[model samples]
Target: MGPRNMAQGSSQKPEFFVNPEFITTKTRAIADRKRENTPVPRFTALVPRGHTVPVLNKNTLVESPDGSYRDGPSTHGTDRFERRRADIVAAAIPVLNDQGFKGMRLTAVAELIGLRATGVTYYFPRKEELAVACIESGFAVLDGLVAEAEREPDAGARITQLIALFTARDAAVRQGEAVPLASFSAIRSLEGEHRDRAVEGYKAMFRRVRALLESPELAAMDQTDRTIRAIILLEQLFWAASWLCDFDIEDYPRLAARMADIVLNGVAPGAIADPIPSLTAPARPLASRDESKESFLKAATRQINEHGYRGASVDRISASLNLTKGAFYHHNEAKDDLVAACFRRSFTIMRETQIEARALAAPEACRLAATVEALIRFQLGPEGPLLRTSVLSSMPVEHKTEILGHSYRISRQFASMVVDAITDGSARAVDPMVAGAMVHAAINIAADARPLAMAQAPDIVARFVRPIFAGFLAA
Candidate 1:
């Protein structure tokens, strides 16, 4: 009988195959034939009782008397599963970037891919597992780019190449040709083994990027110099995703070239004697009316920076301050209220420092240097550590909007300094907006240097700030 007649008229039971290889071959044949106007032959697969009936295609399977379709594990089936899992991860990355790990919802991710929550859990089992996957995917992409950059002959070229590659990838992502890169802001929100793995992956990536600055020409740069430079480079790239959206995709290459110039040959005019001026004294503490409330805000900012909004519970914040939850409620009505206050405190510090630097009697370039040095000092000082902009991802939309507005104002202030320096011919001609954004990124990431010994503050500024102002390859 013909295949169509056999499927339609046969009363006899079809043979069931127990071997997966045989099932795979037979399934492919039937699928191929079905495309040629041939009917798919009925087939059954032997599965242990209570086991999930393997399916080749949901529509192609035939149900038996026991209501089980005949199918077995096959290469095609596994490939399909992997593709589905990838689709889910791709959908989850943008959500993670926008809402943070604390705000990410598995159901929302599933909905984006037109799947049920159960469909996602079938692969990831838990939200944490899915988050880890998303983070690891980002790491994989970064590692690939770094590997490509390593092929360059020198540190400067490698750094430039890396920036260009990242800009290209980001442009592709914006164009929807690739998945969005996962933000590392919420890595601290992961718990247990996941957090450890993520941290280790980050360290590995850092080490690799640092190696890019190890050529003989840069031999004078010690490990500390390399470490600080690596941190600045990585942080700027991380911050790029936030602002890169402001420009058109067609301008990415130009933007990348400008960014590479800023990194390689800072905003200074023909090599200055001292790219970064030494601060005679540490930054004075920002005046606060209520010391106790200031202490609470500092503690809360640290907790939130380290553990994310969801992970930084009121109990944790209170415990950090050696206060009871009642005391927290007494000072702040809600955690969000305290976070808002922390943001305000951070903005106040930046604004006051800008005002102080603007009033400096030195040149515009020196004024800019003083401003960066003071902010970095404040980041490393006691009662310091301005809130990281990453926390904006975990905030409510209204709060995020308000904080971002304040942040842009501060960035524009730095731009004003750059404009002044350019007009005075003390700084190189560069994009003021981009230069300002780089300065903002530098100070924001200064908090990362807190782990280094306090005595290294000058060293931090020399290796970190000078390279930023004079260029990474500056003498």
Candidate 2:
């Protein structure tokens, strides 16, 4: 089916109908008010008055005295239909972020807004449609931030401004003034035209961010350098939301400044020569002794990385390995078991690499650099592409918590290394915790760099890992 048709309900097709009175008296007035006061752009596009598409003004749904959102008089009188739809979108954002598209349930979203499954289906017939809407809203929010950042005089200033704006918006979300941003990692689980639209939107946002590095001062960098840096910056921003909860909301601005400092100037000391170590040895094999189970996990990890946890069905995993369903069950008890195993395998590989890198006779900074380079190389290698951390969203709460505990321990290990680097005078006096988290984020995101040819591992490490150690603007 086509993109538009895929979004329609089986019994009734969605119509682009909105009441004119609501547009003039409510939506336009709010838009005008927001335009006059807010320097940053609003979340979604507001179609002109009398347009066929309904006005989706998230600002109009105000919180009542009881803390629940109550529709305005115009919404009750004229645009109840559209208002209800907007409410569903707002409620679904957090659910989608937590559960991913595969785990997101229409009934769960319905419960949040006190609507039946049928009620939500009336607005968004298919869950994919609702998911697409959530993803689009996320893109709109990011586009607004990028637009605000573009006003800065240079790339460094723009990057700093971007982080500041993100933290401010995040603070607003915490204060209940805005909706939570949707997670884009699960976009891979979407199929057909829905996936196409989401991917296009993401690429558009990526292009805008990549353009930030196009200033005359940064003109010496090639497109490949810019692309790697842009992805690092964007991934770090996305990853920030996951860990920002550790600090009080009041510390957001301070955290943003520190994060920007790390991104712009990096963690290396000014007098340090060659932040990256010359590690010519090949990465040690990350596979387990059980070749049969290892084969299953390798295929499963690749599938999960590409199609998400839910989309990576037992059938798909079996077929990828030229094995039958019986074979899958013979080795694994259930799909969740497989997913948990993948997470364990990934964690083991990371910890082993860290241990090996630390054992090197090299300086602390070189050990950290070697660790990151080895991980990136493994990501592009044959045994490669570790399970993405995004899969944690699709997992059950208990499983997710356990996995997160493992992840935290690994991150703490990295933090210790950074502390050592600082003490040894090889790294700058950056927050070891923040720097470690950033390093963890970068390594986790390296699995997404599968398109980079294995032959270019050295250049990829230079362009990607070097930037993380030394600043993004480093020659």
Candidate 3:
């Protein structure tokens, strides 16, 4: 089936897979620790130590020279405390983007706001609580955009408005006009109440976009296809916050409009483009045990990509490769170690393909186009698996931090290529960082775009890259 058809039609939208739930007894134990005032083990990546706890209830209302209060919470006292928390969250936004949920540190956030870590921690007792606040603040901004988009009388205009809103809001956040919030991508790293809130925000956004995509004008499109397209569009928009700072501040509206156009019509210079090619069959088998190990990795990647890390089991992955659990254990000591290996493999493949593209003797645009095509083909090929970093969240805290460092390095490499392209005049002048992020986002979302497989890789790459770069309409 095509990527479009991969979306299973149902009255309910599918829930994204989360990390495996803790054992009932273990969960209870943790709750018991909380009640007993004993320190429970927390993910080091999610919560760093060494912050001084704030003294309770210092409600002084001294006035500062800048007309701000010296001491007070936002609602009760003088609103100074609330403003301080807001400032810390803002500083933490870029850190969250750079370090991700698992890697972000309260010390880093405190440094950003020129406050001691203890001062910041006084307001937020736990890192999870702070992260939750940031994530929710971001959603509030996004929800406002969606609400405004809903005001459009024509359903056709809704999508474009949303795209523009996302782009502009991202710009506003970067400029410090608005508070910083974690992108929806951070949702994977959250658990418990934080995860629940983030999930609700995502579901609401999905429903609105899905409804807009199902308009009469899009009647020719299947409902499932529409759902998939909406997801693709949202991914592109949500990732905007990462790169918007790299571009000229004034270009947001135009860039947003271009993005909307590309999402809706696609970047075919003239006539409508043909569909991209799809994967046909699995890779050929080998006899050696070494080959078996490789096979297990590939199958494991695919299984994880299809069903989240929690859902994909050793039995299922091994079964797909016609191997026993013994064979699986032969290749790896444990699932956590195996998954970390899988992530390394995925990053290595992508980095290698990108390096090869750069070595090609061609114009920068052509080189970029080649790299994009190669990556997509690899992602859809028998050996190709989508780069789902959600795997990082399921691993040990130490592993999560290590993998995140590697991912950031890869992203910088991508940004470097974009900078080279813009400087060489092979691509339009935009924020290279933003452009690079958009490319990564596209590749990530395309994994589920099974429909693209029906077309050739070059054509598919062109269709996908065109919307982001050349845009759909000609000047």
**Who wins the lDDT comparison?**
2
Predictions ranked by TM-score, top down?
A: 2, 1, 3
Candidate 3 Cα lDDT to native? 0.55
**RMSD of each candidate relative to the true structure:** 14.5, 9.8, 14.2
Tell me each candidate's TM-score. Answer: 0.81, 0.82, 0.53
* lDDT over C-alpha atoms for residue 17 of model 3: 12
Q: Give every collision pair in model 1.
A: 45-70, 266-471
Question: Which tens-of-lDDT digit does each residue in 1-475 have in candidate 3?
Answer: 0001112222231111111121111121111121121222222221112111111111222223332222232335445565455555556666665566667788877765556789878977787767666665554445445554655545557777777656654554444333344555566556787677656756665776676655555566555455545666777775665455556877776677656655554332221122222222222222242665666677887777655565478897888888899988887898877777777777766676677667766556556566666666666655666557644544567678878777767777767886776677665555555556666776767665553444344445444455444442211
Best by TM-score: 2
lDDT of 2 by residue, 1-475 (tens): 1111111112231122222222221122221221221222331222111111112245344223322222233434335564666667767877887788988999988876667899899888999988877776666566556655666779998898788777766665554445666788778899998898788778877888899888999878888888888888988898887788898887787888889999988877342356555443334555545878888989999999999888888999999999999999999998888898889988888898888778888778888888888778778778887898988887878689889999989889989999999999888899888899999998888777786553365577656776788787786
Q: What is the C-alpha lDDT of each candidate?
A: 0.71, 0.72, 0.55
Candidate with better lDDT, 1 vs 2: 2
Worst 10 residues of 3 by lDDT: 47-56
Off by over 4 Å in 1: 1-77, 269-288, 453-458
Candidate 3 to native Cα RMSD, angstroms? 14.2
- Backbone collisions counted per model: 2, 0, 16
Per residue, candidate 1 scores C-alpha lDDT tens digits across 106-149 of 98887776678998899779888788767765665666566556
